[model samples]
Target chain A: MDFLRRLFGGKDNSSSSAQEAKKRLQIVLINDRTDISPQLLENLRAEMIAVLTKYMDIDEPRIEMDRGHDESAVALIANIPVLRIKRGAGGTLEDRFEDNPDDRSEGKFSPRGEPPRNQNIKSRRRK
Target chain B: MGARVIVITSGKGGVGKTTSTANIAVSLAKAGKRVVAVDTDIGLRNLDMVMGLESRVVYNFIDVIEKNCKLNQALVRDKRVENLYLLPAAQTRTKDAVSPTQMSELCDQLRPDFDFVLLDCPAGIEGGFKNAAAGADEALVVTTPEVPAVRDADRIIGMLESMGKSPIRLVINRFRAMMVQNNEMLSQEDILDVLSIKLIGIVPEDDSVIKATNRGEPLTFTQNSPAALAYANIAARILGENVPLLQLDSYHSKGFVASLKKMLGF
Candidate 1:
């Protein structure tokens, strides 16, 4: 009976096996909870890059979303660089700027010594 | 005494939820506890087959719920073990045919008769899962060492917690100790870390399980199978016995590999 008891006994293995099991379990569950496939995330990042490029210049652009340890929902982090134009006198103070310089200055241009008409356009757009 | 209703659920299909339910109920019954295993998998009823009581089910849970038969009439007693019964699900009806309120009421009525009421929940977090969970006081989440099963187990555990259920236990089923030793599989501690639930049992993959199921008999009745002994250990734990969890290292060290390598070449 001792032989049978030893054969069926529950002895402790190294904790390494248990640790590996835990790692595999966590990775699979994280994917399952969000329903966001790895392929989908890659596609979403590409689309987000396209959308951001339409409005601003992003440096080392990256979009990362993950689930927090305790939180039940997905958390998002988006890194985007806003376009900043330095004005210089070349043609009309606008020709020296990048493409669509008017688009950038239209939203938030400080009229310290600028023309009144340009200030009027800015204020009207804000309203 | 009132029966303790436990729902054995695995959001992913075929993670041994029904098998665990059948074996656990059988183990409990063998220990002299009045147990009833209920199949809530409506259209895909297989708990009866696992328990080896398919031919004995004259009336199912639906028949009792619809008042077509008394609750006692729907319960199929197991000839293998005394004080053990099965309330099989209807293979013809879908999950929508029964409501959660009716399930809860049925369990309430069965509580006074049995010591443990095990509900074999269906796969997925759908209507069938909800109805099975509704009548359960506690839950036993079964998952394999694989990623998908563990993921679904986590989701089910979260749902059970949200329902204000306490004492939820995790059963890591179909574990291969050799593969785990070779660092190819997940271990029980790893699963507990991810699910963060109390560890109840770890069932090693045994070929006897297939043979037992084919014969419509639960493995817990077999004395030779390690998986059978594990089920009995789980039942003992449920009866408030402090049984130590099974360890794989000691068993493997004494195997032929170590002994043969110690001897001279033939």
Candidate 2:
């Protein structure tokens, strides 16, 4: 019966009202806990795109920003689709990048330890 | 030790604050502890009706605060349960009738005379809520297993925490076990996870509660009802007793098993 239900895409674990309510509440509480409004998030996304567009040609429409909370901390995560890196668009950062050798060592440019910075933006808000 | 003043509050109305207050007060008084249940819902008071002492309320707490009557004169002693008293709210007055300082002083006056002071707070996070919570050392926030109720409960819990109320606990009322089993309703664990408070009790969805309410008798007066047993366990827990939770699932298992056996023709 379980196998048949799964194959037919019938009512399963994820379809319960309890699960739906839990998901909705988890989202609502993330906002409630952080006191961050959807408008604020939208503005933050706009500002973030403005900052990122100067260095790279990003797919602005596909950009996404969200807040997440877990056991130890709340975080702001962003996903920006980069079309191409604009070389020599800003000369000052290029000059600093050439001068600072320690910024490239062991991927210390990103505070996130293991994951490379190219994939996403993760900034811890609170611990 | 002095009395522990606990305010029973839920930001949303009709989640069984009066019922829990009445039942827990009766349970505590029946255990030979001096207990008083103060109805802080000034304009729309219902604790007197739930406790079946509406006819005995000659004076209310406002009368005591206003110097119209003495404190003991305003307290209506429960005839059904000894050592239980009710400081009923005035039906004609507004929530602004009782200030926080007056409520706290009333609590101080009742503390030395009783072992438990249970303030039945009104709905909403307004003046009535602040007035009721002002006197409480601890709190028991009541909520049903619904989204709005849980959300309001979270708001109340946050306000109570900001007020420096210690040992705030939860009372999840009208919990439908069959609905929870069928994944149609939120479980107590789910509510506790969202509210993040220590659970003091979970009262099952029992029809006897309504019958008792309409008849002006609290469920704790009965011996074996599911809600009665749950309220008794809650009262015991308030007194620092380590009683286990009442098996709410067992309240419906008999009917469930009988139906299953009938369907199987066993």
Candidate 3:
């Protein structure tokens, strides 16, 4: 109900009803389409944040995670805005920047070993 | 080599599955195609009444399924339109009375005789739905522009896809154009995006439909009415005609509310 209320901007007008219904349907159908419950999705997001935080400072509140579908398959799309990498937290700066092709091939989200079609990790560099 | 058995179904109740079935059947029949609308609702039969053949229903679908009556004997020929018939469902029997195999057999029997065999499916995704959809080669999923209806429709579409039913088209029934313009109702695009199926019809909310249903007549019997034209368009599309979608009257909001909507980027 909180999401529904937020969807309509706390207005009870007829104009807002459609928006509310659309949002409610889109949210509810994610489970049916992806076979992942919202609770489970939330848990996954939380785990992702926890893991990513170890090597990078991500803007958790601004993280957008949802199931996106293309002609081929449904994919777990995450647009996590990275504030900066934790250079001193885990390893050397050069080690943290190391991008292994093997690691990239093993997708973080794909449970069936199929890499996600799109995994956008936007770096929000703050000056 | 036979009629394409297309099931007109909606998982939710009272979303115009029966209405769409009646109108589309009538339209197809009027277009010189042999069409039969079978009420697969069993105990909740309304297709016969909608087609104005309730009094002439001597036999029902269950009778044919149980071998109590021949398929031809159970078909109620519509006197109003040539090549149109109604296979009424039994009011006394529950949905359990007709098994999926029996329904498929019934469809096969009607296939060679008609150009299109339309099964009016009952609500809910239960045994009744399975029985109705068992014989279907294609599907017409009906839903209103509401949350619950769209959700159930998505579920039905999923089931139909899993069953390998191809060319599954959507019919968004009882659409209020003005409400959609005012952002009071979900738009056609919103629904199609969610359902992710090809759209065949968008029936506008019309009083004529209620009047026709109450009189035991299909709205398609009337000429050029909004809902009638919509149903006729659906029929034409089914026959592989290149008819464009019906254009409903558009509305523009005025004054303070309009400014508010503009401010909200609606």
Tell me the interface RMSD of every candidate, in Å.
11.0, 3.5, 7.7
Estimate the lDDT of model 2: 0.84
- Model 2, position B133, has a per-residue lDDT of 96
Error of 3 at B222 (Å): 2.1
* RMSD list, candidates in order: 12.7, 8.3, 10.6
Superposed model 3: Cα runs more than 4 Å off: A1-15, A36-127, B247-266
Report the C-alpha lDDT of model 3 over B1-266, residue by residue, as the tens digit.
79999999999999999999999999999999999999999888888888888899998888887788998999999988899999999999888887899899989999998999999999999999999999999999999999999999998998898898989999998888768876789999889877778999888888888899899989888756778878998999999999977443322456765653343233
DockQ for model 2 equals 0.25
**Local accuracy by lDDT, each model:** 0.78, 0.84, 0.83
Candidate 2 chain B has its poorest 10 consecutive residues by lDDT at B257-266
Candidate 1 stretches with Cα past 4 Å from truth are A1-127, B249-266
Separate DockQ for every predicted complex: 0.24, 0.25, 0.30
TM-score of 2: 0.73
Q: Give residue B160's error in model 2 in angstroms.
A: 0.8
Comparing only chain B with the true structure, the TM-scores of all models are: 0.93, 0.93, 0.92
Q: For candidate 1, lDDT tens digit of each residue in A1-127?
A: 6577559984445455556556655555654555445666566666556544543466534434543443332355555555532333224334433555564456322234343232111110001
What fraction of the reference structure's interface contacts does model 1 contain? 0.64
In terms of docking quality, model 1 is acceptable
- Model 1 TM-score? 0.70
| lDDT measured at residue B34 in model 1 versus the true structure, 0 to 100 | 97
